[model samples]
Target: MPRRHDPERRQRIIDAAIRVVARAGIAGLSHRSVAAEADVPLGSTTYHFTTLDDLMVAALRQANEGFARVVAAHPALSDPESDLPGELARVLGAWLGGDRTGVELEYELYLAALRRPALRPVAAEWAEGVGALLAARTDPVTARALVAVLDGICLQVLLTDTPYDEAYAREVLTRLLPAPGTRDGRGPGSLPPPTAG
Candidate 1:
């Protein structure tokens, strides 16, 4: 008789690969390391991912999925006309405030893409995910720019352990937002009034 397979084993391996990268960084990741972390046979790692890049890409994609959940939960994103800065600050605070290792792991993949051209598409997908989320609340141009700024701020927080304070987030937003009553008439750079009292 054929042996029964664990239906969740594949996902568990993927989750384990992320954990290994989170704890040890990408340089330490390997099929052997991941198998040890996952407590699975080395064959399982090979069975799931034929190459290291494949494993890293899977981990990056998984991280993106988690970020998407955060974006989906933010209230301001649901209504484009609502106060964005405060809501965005709150959303970012919630995202960056927890789990430093996870944040580090994300930056690891981000930086890795710079050195490895093969990973660039995964990096672009990650950036485009944020851009699309922001576009829900603003025009594509502003969304693209804001995503870049947001990534910078996030990198700062990740590197310096800077407080993910709402005031700081608002300050950044203030610079990017258009002056009130611009000719565009609430399009693109125009933003809702500050929500913070």
Candidate 2:
């Protein structure tokens, strides 16, 4: 009899590990812990990953993939400078927030990296890739600053219980935006069509 490939099962365990980390913190993770979450045999965890190091790396990749998706889905609006408070608010509202998605899981992996040195590179890549993504969206001089604040906002909101006001986020984001009609890395202003009269 042919044995069915449990590649899907292995992925299922990795996803479960991320959620477990999100809920219980990575400190609580173990073969048993993840296996319990996935309702799989302990041997399966060993079968898929020979060492805890392997498992942690796999989990980090999973987290990075998810973060990439969120970033691609919600990019900041172009020309934040020209947009008034209303348009600014709309853009921030649609942006990737701290806790709304699973920022917690990613942060937890960050902590885990302190214990697992191999995971650090993967985690660092996540930060750099996301930073570059935002920076590329804005003027060269301000791009890094813009990315930093947006990332900071997510970190702040995650640590709190209070509601995050979209309007307020925009205000903060507005200050972070480049001056209106300023040129990018490319030369002079590249203006868009005029809005309705």
- Go through the candidates in order and give the clash count of each: 0, 0
Model 2, 14-116: lDDT tens digits are: 9888877878877788898899898888888888888877888888888878756654554443344434333434444454344554666776676578788
Please, what's the RMSD in Å of model 2?
6.9
- The digit string of per-residue lDDT tens for model 1 on 109-161 reads 87888887778899999888788877776778877877877888887877786
- The lDDT for every candidate, in the order shown, is 0.77, 0.65
Poorly placed runs, candidate 1 (over 4 Å):
1-4, 179-197
Task: Return the TM-score for each candidate structure.
Answer: 0.83, 0.68
Count clashing pairs, candidate 1.
0
Query: Among all windows of ten consecutive residues in candidate 1, which has the lowest summed lDDT?
Result: 181-190
Task: Find the candidate with the highest TM-score and give its number.
Answer: 1
Q: Where is model 2 more than 4 Å wrong at Cα?
A: 1-5, 75-101, 139-141, 178-197
Any residue pairs clashing in model 1, and if so which? none
